[model samples]
Target: MVQKIGAQYLAKRFADQLMASPEPREEPEEVVRETTEVSGDLDGQIFHDEEGQPIGRAYLVRQVEVYVVSPTRAGAREELVRCLNEPDSRVYLREVDGRLSGVVYTPDPARTGERTGAMRADDV
Candidate 1:
């Protein structure tokens, strides 16, 4: 029997694929700032690509939607909060309608405290 995968699992798989692929090209800092919209302060700062361009999704810390594969919503929320507080952890944010609507914790090489990249929430 094929086991159904939850949203969190799928998201993690997607993130793993992105991490395995070649790093994205970097653009000028000014251009990145103008194109990207971020609203939260991560514990370890935002990530950046090899050329110094930021990598990963953007979102407001106040409205991060956590998707934990838990049986209860409260459990999921607790997991989300825990993930957010992790030191140097990279939480990928998903934006919606110009605001942050979702977030997923994933492993990324660009989580080195440098903010770069112009990422649209819908893209995720």
Candidate 2:
């Protein structure tokens, strides 16, 4: 017999895996605040952080594969973008069947900028 897991269980499992992973090296504060524009399919308005600093405006680039685990590929892509826009959420990417899939977890509601209407790339 097979067992089915709820979304909450899956979420917790993903979070636990993330907690067990290595930490990423931190970048200097100035570098993180630099502003740059993203063009093409992923287009949207820009917004600032609580300190009036521009958000999502860094020039230093790194490749990231965002995955949203859903029943449909389209749903996964949509969820990925939604999670990316959340200021306080930590996104975790994992490889499944040779493709990268991601799970977003928000550990702190206080840090979440949901009320501020942070920058978003919904059109992507």
Candidate whose lDDT is highest: 1
Give candidate 2 misplaced runs (Cα > 4 Å).
Answer: 1-47, 50-52, 55-57, 82-90, 93-124
The most accurate candidate by TM-score is 2
Per-structure clash totals for the candidates: 2, 1
Q: Write the per-residue lDDT of candidate 1 for residues 1-124, one digit (tens) a residue.
A: 2345677788899999988968888866764323234433554567778998989755445446556433356666665565567675566667889887886763233443454468899989
Q: Please report the TM-score between candidate 2 and the true structure.
A: 0.26
RMSD for each of the candidates: 25.0, 23.1
lDDT (tens digit, per residue) of candidate 2 on 22-49: 8898967764545355443234445578
- For residue 108, model 2's alpha carbon misses the true position, in angstroms, by 14
The alpha-carbon lDDT assigned to residue 105 of candidate 1 equals 64
Residue 40 lDDT in candidate 1: 39
- TM-score for candidate 1, residues paired by index: 0.23
